[model samples]
Target: MNEQNDNAGLFGSGDEAPSNHSNNPHFNDLVAGITRRQILASSAALGSLAFLGATLPSLAEAGEQTVASQPLKRRNRLPFTAIPTSRADTISVPPGYKATPFIPWGTPITGRYPAFADDASNSAQDQAEQTGMHHDGMHFFPIDAQRGLGRQSDHGLLVLNHEYIDAPLLHPNGPTVVNGKRVNAEEVRKEINAHGVSVVEIRRNVRGEWDVVPSPRNRRITAATPMQIRGPARGHKLLQTRYSPDGKATRGTQNNCSNGYTPWGTYLTCEENWAGYFASADADMPRELSRYGLRSSSRFGWNTLPGDEFERFDATRKGASATADYRNEPNHFGWIVEIDPFNPESVPIKRTALGRFAHEGLIFAPAKAGRPLVCYSGDDSQNEYLYKYVSRDRYWPGFSHGRLLDEGTLYVARFNADGSGEWLALDITNPRFLKACLTARVTFADQGEVLINTRLAADVVGATKMDRPEWGAVHPDTGEVYFTLTNNTARTLADAANPRIANAYGHIIRWREQSRDHTGTRFNWDLFLLAGPQTDSRGPDGTALTADNTLASPDGLWFDPDGRLWIQTDMSGSQLSNGPFGNNHMLVADPRSGELKRFLVGPLGAEITGITATPDFRTLFVNIQHPGEGSTATNLLSSWPDGPGKRPRSSTVIITREDGRHIL
Candidate 1:
């Protein structure tokens, strides 16, 4: 989900820092009187005006080590600091509170047409009228019909997750290709309908309100949107692309990245760096080129250039068969999608019984009438494997009550270094590993090639390989799940769920579940935080540590509605891309006091992607993206969430705690 880089924004240093930690003045006078009772009432009058302006903080609502034992510091804390470069476009919180843009980057949407013009000419209906650009992992579903309620909120259903696009500020003078091919099939169908998922519906206005309700039931699910792949790598033949010649509808849903929702509400999303946007030629099929992991998909020159939407991402076959040319458009793209963000007519279903790699997040587990509802996923690649599906039916919480997300039963994941792990079942009852609908080798016409070769049948059943895993949350109070192994520069040579070798910085595994507390068959784990930098560097037994508990590449991860967790950096290794681990920051962990801070640091060439909160844990969004990518969008490097001459636009900001507390 990062490469073409540069959305610009770093207006050569100016300076200005000292506000936001509730931007003080009495924590912005208590989130300005409880968000002005959320724009003047109507979530049961803002839960009776937050139980008449909810007082009773007992240490700001005990969570995250009670907001990390209250001493926050940082008016210039670590030897680390930066954001002053005239604070371009502005958004530097931590002092007392204040962050706005709950969503930006061609904003407005309600079905279609409004965003276009950073020089214009983008259509696929300006990607359902815009709101997709590196957003990443979100969740706010609190229309609270009250069930364990107390943290009152006004309106909800945010979803959000774009995860890709910058192609020279998204068109008008960039992304054309014209000769090596790809002269913009309508700017690659407006950058694959500005990559997937949107949902918006937030509320609470009238001075005590939430935001984003652009209306007409605002919705969008791009990358062409039109799913239904469901399990066992649907029609395998590696997801046969070229516009579903036989892959069963799959127009789009690129890099998606983190997101989850179920309990019967449905939303899932996920799809990390989706096999580097295709380039493949690694000598015409080196085993479908090392079975669908494409070591070079992001050369971003868009397959020779000029169109048929970037020459169907070169899957070879060069013509004569597979129903002539366009070699099945990169097997439709890494799976997991799901949507139905509250059924806006619904249709986003890639579930393929959930098994595609590069995915990154999918949580869900607490469902147990008769058992088998489990979910947990992660395969963000690099050493892959750590999936789970289990759902041969049992959860009837509303039993798909408004269109249940198609039956379930997908599995693949093994992890066991005595640490213990096992789920397996990519099923067909495993006739020699994922084979099933064998109408003579046409294999699995149903569970979609078992979630599309679910990482080649978890490498034909063995499973385990990790490191790069990215997001996964849960523990709405001990249902425990936590994930983020995010950095593993290919550890050990032994294969199978990472046997252990030069792993680099990464570690944060978690577990717990023996019988339906979000059951993934059986659970119980450990080894929580271990990113890197305490010393040794990479070893004399090197575990390294400290950047306030050092963190190398731990990509976008969340866990808010008060269970804490946050994290965010992509670090880029080589000592944070160019010395002294500068940009990319968001940290805040505390999984029961293993502590670790940082709280916010993103600017000069950003990377701290997505975070989400707002279920009354009062605001907290996140998502910086592209800041100063490949440089020069007019000499930018990061004006941050808003700064500089205005070019960097991978928006989403929110953040709160200077006194409205509760931000461990």
Candidate 2:
């Protein structure tokens, strides 16, 4: 998903396109390959991307990123260009800051065990005992400063999400396959443990140091961890699996993408692009079949492995109906999970109040003491829909919220062709839903059912479909929410959300709430960014359509502490080696002026993701995920931070302004 934009983070996969993969093709609609006579004149003008390997590497290697390794003009200095963009192997930060590999795959998060044993064959239980990777979106909770812990104390909690797995290099001999099949149940158990979230307590010393503080509160949630399923789907026949016969609960959270934190103190981890892993065989799992958009087994063929653990993707209960067969297991996943990070003793819960899709991230509006709480999300797929949820109860300050989260209405966004939009509530209370379900004989006993089956309900209401929506961040100064609309491969002009014929570059669209009311139905919106070549695909459209303004596939997005919006890229296709842009890089934008420029570019074969700023606005943390991602550990395509000879590793970089100045 990082390679494209549908799923913004490096962990997940995207949903299927409606008709085609992408809406726009590079040139004019004309497909002319004429004879020698016709070849005399030019047919179409084409644009180029600056992502080619040979040219990019040669240019980057010639320059140096060792700017941080030497002395500086300022005493408490910051490295201006300490890290250069390269296809090398390592993460980079400012000269004054250091990036330690705090956590990696299979590392223990509880701080109870020694470092992970190299080549260790850990089990599902052991996995539940360790920290998971690739660590995607994270937030630092100040336990001492704000949570009433202690004033002026530099210590707090770290809440993070483990998005998904990096399968190839996970095992010693590559997942122990027996005759083209997965090796053992033990391997499957190890993988299950790697898929959830981690919450740990960290503290800083008077010397300004940061380290983990081992406490009983430190905990982990793995594949087999016990989670409470709270939604309409709970106890539904479709969710009944061999593991949970009653279907009231399930195992773990998979493909967790971007995350959000409620003002009331709960973690929202989204499940995105989850359907790709399942294999719904026609004859074996008719209950799991969905001819409209249902897919076959995963491309990785993990189900073919030689054990039952590898067979969960089969999606059949071996019984008669949905209840009999446990065929609806896939439904249990693909929903947003809410975890009480501070309450380590309590189990994490999945809030079905939010409609399901390829959930990229969940961002909430600033809570007013008596106002209805609201949140927004994007379905990370080509030509998907933007969504919002309104809490049924006003947010209660302090630590008073317990069951109110379960009672809410979910809605999908509909952007009008005239630039206005509406949030259609998908609740049983609506006349349309009540009448439709009654006529169709689909019984809905309570609000829980409505929240659980949110997608179907939204479809009945009709919401405006949008380009692939990714990670989103709200502008603290303006209260406007900005979300990344990664390119829709099947982008077409027939839809209002996508007006242009060839939406090659994609865009970042934002909207401001009317009077800052989260429950208000109407709001004003605008096109904050238009991505592509900033030139043209060669048509009647103005060259203004595709020029320096044009940049393909906007992905990771976040608002820095100072309110500056940082935009990152995920260029795939012909753009990489043959494109015009130098390489995938992170850019900074003045949201007030729309004046944007490249702040830092990344090396080849890497996606810049998960950016956050320190509370004081003096420091920034950015993730360099999956460097040389396409390369095997043996082949070694990219050298990256250290260059070719060293091993490629994923790490976080701390960016600070040079001269110790405030970053604008």
Q: Number of backbone collisions per candidate, in order?
A: 94, 42
Where does the lowest 10-residue lDDT sum fall in candidate 2? 46-55
| Top-scoring candidate (TM-score) | 2
Total clashing pairs in model 2: 42
Candidate 2 per-residue C-alpha lDDT over 561-605 given as tens digits, one digit per residue, 9 for 90 to 100: 556677877776466666565466676665433345556655566
Candidate 1 lands at a TM-score of: 0.32
Candidate 1 per-residue lDDT, tens place, 1-664, comes to 3232222121111111111111111111112223322322222211111112223122223332334565332221122232221222344545555666556656766755475455445465766677876677776666552221224466766777887766666665566564445554566677777777787777778874357776655687876666767544556555655566676666668778677767655567887666556656646554333466554334454555655556666666666665455555555566677776655776777765665566767777666555666778776655556776666556564443312334566665554433345566766666645443342243444556555555655555555555556677766665667687766543334222222356555666666555554544445454455565555232101123454445566666666655556777765425445544565676665443333566676655666676666555666667776666644455555555445555666767766654655444
What TM-score, computed on C-alpha atoms, does each candidate reach?
Answer: 0.32, 0.79
lDDT of 2 at 202: 69
